[model samples]
Target: MAAVPALPVSLSGRFKGSFAYFTIKDRLPQILTRVIDTLHRHKNEFFEEHGEKGVEAEKRAISFLSKLRNELQTDKPVTPLEDELPDAALWNQYLDYQRNLPNGNGEPSWFQSPWLYVECYMYRRIHAALAQNPPIDNFDVFKEGKAQNFFESQEAVIALCTYFQELLKNIKDLDEKQLQEELFKLLQVSLWGNKCDLSFSAGEDSSQKSSPLQSLENMVPYILVNDMEKVWSLLVNAKKNRTERSNVRVDIILDNAGFELVSDLVLADFLLSSKLADEVYFHGKSIPWYVSDTTKHDFNWTIKQLGSANHMWMSRCGINWEGNLKKGVWVFHDHMFWTLPHDFSSMSEVASDLYAELQKSNLLLFKGDLNYRKLTGDRKWEYSVPFHQALNKFHPAPLCSLRTLKSDTQVGLKPGQGEQIQASESEWMGELIFILRHLIELQ
Candidate 1:
């Protein structure tokens, strides 16, 4: 067994009362209830599609989800998955790893293990239950909520698409100054769009309040550590130093499903139309995850939804996006590795193929809080620890984590910056702090 590094910040600490504890105690069960509840409402549809056998599968799936909920609420042992997914063995192996921890009773329990591990395990367990039962195996319990959330961001979607239309129309006319301004604006839009995360609000639609592109100046003060200039330089240097702009590739490891997705698409569109990247690759989850992580369904659905919307600019944006896919300007990929619980630092060893594929990109953008956690290994590092050290040599390509703070694990702050931010304790308007690998700090 790999020597487990310093014990992670577990949800069930000695006293059993951190946010992680609260999540397992309250939030996670609530999410499962909604999953089962959605199944209940769709019971007849399952019967309609799969006959009596489908009905039986639906009942079994619901029961499994309910029982899963019970184990979490009561803090029972996390049952290792029994399945055929390639990564299933790895999951089971980690369960064994946790089982042998100093305080473990030769078993992994919900509240006692690393919060990130067990929390991720719950979702994979749900997938396993469904995979074992047919017809329902393809059903996403969260599909309804995801689609509704997408529609709910209609106004912001229109405004953003309209902004894309305006800026992209004059792309060739813009000088470097104008080009950087547009890229920076869209980066903030993509970063702040993360605030609308459904998982953070426990599946509620957190809509964009006003025009995302119009709000950047007001958002300046909220960014605690801005490495965007360095990011810009990387892109600019790649464009100038490379033989052709089209050779540069930008890979975005996406997050969320609603407005956040739209923001990512808009930025991707800019990268392509402005020639910052020859091709844009988007990575999404292969299964339902963290309530709102992008999956193949969510990615296709958002693009089709935008392309076919009633509004003009919105529809045009969608149509253009469709054309981009058809022409191969934008490529989409989903790897099982994404849904696995391993921190990115384990990428080269555990998911070497993905690690190698990422090396092809000129730059990689990891979006939102969960991705940020995986990037930093979710350790309880002293805030001033240099960011590269926290990455533990996970660099497959030059990368950036554009995340809003939603979890307790953070690093790369200047001296005392962490405590100062904690003392204010104010609800955020919205914020985006990009943590770079300090090893790549621009001279």
Candidate 2:
């Protein structure tokens, strides 16, 4: 078989005066300021937790974050990561790749490098700051916002949990068509959940403000390309094709916390209870990222929150979700590569272990915009570019990107459709959805 080629990574230069550039120059600095202020506000708590040493560490982290912000503002070249984390080497190696790109000058700067690289570097640099400060090293600077977002969506969380619990009780009695309808419904719920990201909202509230389950049907018109049938067919047909469908695995590349995380769990629970998947694995970030992207801490905290909520059905769902973990049917995994800025196409070369593990799954569902960006390589493709082309070499298994359009770059649109939407709707991109199907096919 021929080796698959990697897709082009979006450069900040190509899209100057675009969202990508604005993010690096203005928005990123604002985010860094919040992070620095967050550390300062927590200084007293750190001191209480780790004494004077913790206070000193907080100051150090703050100092490091402040400097990082300045570098972005001034277009300073991105330096090699100074961390002991195993993935730091992969990151630095990728930096070398960027530095050697056709550009004349050697060093990769925020304004000159791939948007994905520099954006991801921002988060890793944040971790490096805290990592350099021992006492507060393990503390997530974004935890408070995550917690607040989750609590703010309490009503939506309860409604969705209640719906899932009800579905579980009657799932056995549900006919194939009813099950399919519910599956598609929940999937759409999960898709819309992508909008609940704080990073896209610039550190403001972006939680689901209403009952997601109730509004699922009404949002159907917004899905520009719907291949829910293909996805469902992939699962059911895979069942028929197999001799025995015992170890069917579905990997969910998870997105945000709060209601978005809850939506993912609800979908996971449905997949399990409906027997669409026998085992489910969730991939989360290793560190705080994109404001609300799920970290291991966020993943575990969401389950615990659900398990201990005052609402009966939500609490029940949480306990059972946790039990799935105990029974080894549901698993949570965190890999440094997910947090890295590299395109998914580079996984085999950069994080072969993660790529190989993904190949074991029957299906992989990537949620939210950043994962979507990485999957599509965040490149400028013709609107009608085949989604598989955008995927490049990332066909590890049967995979579907269940993402809402948040970023400017998107693929898999029909001819002239992109131009039409660009003209008609100001926020047309975010308001639409598209799904393409590929199943366990490797070239």
Give the TM-score (vs. native) of candidate 2: 0.94
Native RMSD of candidate 1 (Å): 3.1
Checking candidate 1 for backbone clashes, the offending pairs are 307-318
Please give me the total number of clashing residue pairs in predicted model 1. 1
CA RMSD of each candidate after superposition: 3.1, 2.3
Candidate 1: worst-modelled 10 consecutive residues by lDDT? 429-438
- Candidate 1 regions exceeding 4 Å error are 1-15, 101-106, 244-246, 426-443
Q: Summarize candidate 2's per-residue lDDT along 225-344 as a digit string, tens digits.
A: 677888888888766665573577889999898888888888888888888888899999887888888988888888998899889998998899889999999899998888877889
How far out, in Å, is residue 266 in model 2?
Answer: 1.1
Report lDDT per candidate. Answer: 0.80, 0.82
Candidate 1 overall lDDT versus native: 0.80
The true-versus-predicted C-alpha distance at residue 57 of model 2, in Å, is 0.9
